[model samples]
Target chain A: MTVLVTGVGVVLPGGGRLADLGRTEAGSLEPVDPRSRINRRGLRYKDRATQLAFCAAEEALNDAGLYAPAAEAPVRAEIGIVVSSNFGNLDTVCRVTGTIGAEGTLAASPMDLPNASSNVIASSLAIRFGLAGANLMLCSGATSGLDALSWGRRLITAGRCRQVLVLGTEPDNETVREFTDTPRMLDGAVGVVLEDAGTAAARGAVPRLTLGTACRGGTLADCVAVLAAHGAPARWYPPEAVTADVLDGLFPGATRVDLAQVWGASSGALGVLQCAAAIGWFDGGGAGPVYAVTGGGRDSAAGHVFTAPPGVAR
Target chain B: MSAVIAGAGAVSSVGRSVDDIFTSLCGGRSGVGDLRVFDRTRYRAEHAYEMDDRPPGGPDVPLRTTRWLLAAIEQAARSGGLGDDLEGVPVLVGTGLRELRSVELRHRGAADIGPADLHFGPAVRERFGATEIHTLANACAASLSALALGADLLDAGEADAVVVAGTDMITESMFGLVERVSAVPPDRVRPFDRDRLGAVMGEGACAVVLRRSADARPALGVLRGVGINCDAYHVTAPSPAGMAAAMRQAYQRADRSPTETDLVMLHGTGTMLNDEAEATALTEVFGDRAGRPLMTAIKSMTGHTSGASGLLGLIVALRSLHTGAVPPTLGLENPVPEAAPLRIVTELVEGPSLSTAQINAFGFGGINAVAIVERAR
Candidate 1:
């Protein structure tokens, strides 16, 4: 019943396309419309969150080589979609609520109501790709991204879907501003394609790692400790572990990467950034096990332990 | 995969607990009363089933809605005989108003609010000690969506048990929205009646403890499947032809035909457009067999509970399956002339063992959700 991750794609504050995100960028991370570059029209109406999801989904499908033709092939109808966000469509919500509050009730615009929905991203993707399987949106604050990942793994392990597109997305808005005074509300998306070991091997897909047991703890400290016991590097810490003293306690030898410098201090998008960091470290031919901790003040934490591939130095 | 309703609870104008509400319902009592939830002197709708009994505190309950939500969850846990603390249990709450009161207070300049003041997710977490909590704001369909997602979590093995709650209280802001939509009536809600004008507003909260069938107690019914569909046609009005796709999807997922259903718990908001569309959808889907499934509209008695309507209907369906009798549809003296020839239940009648029931909840944003529940032998 174990699920394996075959591919990972990300659109984050670190800039670059999904393929280039993991590698060193020549310049700073900048926001670019991947859809526009790809000549996809009518994408202007989509918010940054939806755009991020499209970019990541496109990249993941490309990496897995699951094109429209392949998706429409005579395979089982078993592709589930699980998308999660903390402040889902916060930008849209703020706009709608502000409009309703400022203007008279009768004057409230209807254009923004659809965008305020938490499931808009997933629903849009499903309609675009004709994915008629299970679709769910999880909004559990900081842990939402991991929750989606867990559900995707479960779908594969339970034989409900041959593969699942687990997306983690967040768009910057006033809600993010209220959470952190700093501009941490970065916009990004990451999608991981999960499949069972049998299906993966049948398709000649080499899994990067076996998705392991995910447990929720009462607090971030407890979560970190549990992950550490399961082989997570002790140097990793929660997002709040940014204080100098806490950083000293966690990462002793590693030089800190100022994530805020590239992507703001947003909570939900941190998971995508962390996933990007893990992929970056792996692509750089790093050795041993690298731990990625993503969570915030909501007491939500997801620890991912990445072990180097064989022949990679420890 | 089967999902069992391990525990259920409700806090409405009908009653605060399941047993209390069931007794009142069986006795054919109505919960409709004066509209005290807001200043109704200026409004046309002056009657509703407003929950006036506060739980040991005033309006300052962190998130005002969370107080009622906690009570319902606690009742569900108690009824299910679960002793485990909800330390790590995922919480999914369906609410049309995520602290609507708080927003009103801020708008009136009665209180200064922060980001946390905008919603109920954090308040529920603090009250129930959930490991993770999610809030769904799909209007009337919110609770059904929460239940559907919770069932998915169990089916996917995400959690051993989940607490899914739906809560909303009457708010002036929401009333304004209702007034604008022309869905609010001047007095009591009368569903499926020829003289029905519109729906009266009400407020309530309901929760269900969902678990895998293997882990649940033997007495509860089984949640067979749930189907959800959204019509991108309009934000306020339903799809012109009705949610035919959603109905088909529900039956398809349940592995049953419209003829196999024993009862249909209609949304029956008493709104002219809503009732007509529902009747058309039913006739189109079921045809001659539409009358075979005994139909009842509970909103006539309880008023429109908004987000809690889905769970309220779920509770009533469970009761019907247990008692082998369907509750009467109140306030339907004369059926609409154009309505389908369905067997509208006007008086409670003992019938054959009801095997399956379908509950539908349509929201403001064209969100349609239907859940099929089966009697667990």
Candidate 2:
């Protein structure tokens, strides 16, 4: 069973859609207030990271034509969600932690306690969207976003769910900045709607691209070796740590595109953002077999191969 | 093919080794005591289940969660006979707070926090030489989710052996949060008791080395399947329907009927709503057979270990399957009305010849995960 990326949504700096992913450089892009993009009813108590997730999720659902009126929402339990974020809700967690440290633990509001949990963003998204499928939250360093996609694919192929919303988001806040040291900070969310190809066809939804071989390993060489099993990639989206000389040695003929340089440090959003960029490349008449690899400056890395779907003009 | 538990390790407040913990549980000993991890005078309740074997430097140490995790992993590897080197094998960690306690300790002028300590990936890499790592924070159901992912990796031929583990340290913030939220100050965790107040916080780490059944190694038990789902209901509150659905899903994936289940490890948190809801879920899933499955809530003695609770309960259930001696749910003098439809183990049962067991783990955000395990034939 093949998995298809049917929808793409991102809350990047400036104003760039799925088509302008690689071309437009997000230069010190300021975060946008999610209240303007999403419903304001449930926006009061949610943290900024969750609110950003909501914005990106709304756009992705709308793009997939899966967004329905509240009263018209069909059985939502058939859909699942996988979220990847390392520092998305650290601001809230730190604030609550600090409040309990300064004042008594009773000082922290009951409303804010839920946000202290690492799974808050994923759970909040599920509650807001009424998705009851196998929900998961991944925070496995830089390759987290790719791990989320991998899990989403497993959930679909395992028949746990027909469609899974995979989200990768990060927020650059005071607390996150204190804990993290990155070349560039990102404050945005990227979402993709992954559906079983058969389910997509039955729903009359056009797929952006077909997911291909995916691999994760302890080192860049391991991932590269496994991802190269099918054939040499036409284009390679390399991690920030991989230089042109290394890429040349590895892929040789393939073009190297670094999205981290295009848009600041992606953190957990690296892999999903890379997939969104691949979707844009395919839409712009790019060729097939593009591999996006990310190693969050750690010993581990995750990579996925994206191929243009059959019948798509290359 | 089912994934076999090749080796297991655990370090909870009750005991350090799995055998010791099982013995403590069977002896009906309660680990709950005065909260010493933090200043307890500020809270209404001074009692908690704190680990006696804390690493050197007391409670204000950095990498507290990492230390516990590495200890458990070491024990798991040693017992599973996997040796010290785990070079190519993948390690999946399920943690609710991860190193939040460490981060909190850093605030009070503790050792400088390393970036690698924030997630278990770097530490696992450094210690075990594991290249591929996944850390999941699926609330309290985190470990079961990791176990499920491990099973999936085995099923897909991704790894011949995978280490699935969960660890969490009770932070002052979390301890205080529980204290402030409970309807009444919880003096003890009385799961399914009519007068149950709320859950007390506990800290520990547990790990299991999973290998394919075809490995021809000694097996603790066979992990049949794990079912995970979100209630999407409420953040702090659980949904009985969602809980039942997760259990039913596990049974279905395990290809076993509820009638075949001889033991059930309940996710009874001793909270007013959680216990009642769990009882309701049991009734819904088992129907008339709910009373047939012998059930026990280990939280009554271990307290709530957060993410580590799932694996801790699983270790108990596996031991039960092995020895036919089930642990008691201490302090269950009077059963709640909702529990009337089920068989609650008030004292240890030494004989049942248990073959199959189901472990339920429900977390905040309505994340529910249930794992099915069977004795090795």
TM-score of chain B of 2: 0.97
lDDT tens digits, residues A112-159, model 1?
Answer: 444644456765555444443555565555555665666677556654
Candidate 1, pairs of clashing residues:
A184-A264, A184-A265, A184-A266
lDDT of each: 0.66, 0.85
TM-score of each: 0.79, 0.96
lDDT tens readout by residue for model 2, A14-80: 6556776767466546668787787788888888778888988989988898876443464388889
For model 2, what is the error of residue B33's alpha carbon versus the real structure, in angstroms, after optimal superposition? 2.0
RMSD of model 2 against the true structure: 2.0
lDDT of 1 by residue, B1-377 (tens): 57888888888888888877776666667788876644444455567777776444444323456678878888887776564367667778887655556545544454465544444555665666666676666567778877777877887767788888888876555564455455435477788898887877777788888877545356567787776655534445665343665677678766778888898888888888778777878888888887788888888777888777888888778888888877778888888864648787888768668989989887764667788888868
Q: What does DockQ give for each predicted structure?
A: 0.17, 0.65
**Candidate 2 lDDT (Cα, whole model)?**
0.85
TM-score of chain B as predicted in candidate 1: 0.92
Instruction: Report the TM-score of chain B alone for all candidates.
Output: 0.92, 0.97
What DockQ does predicted model 2 obtain?
Answer: 0.65
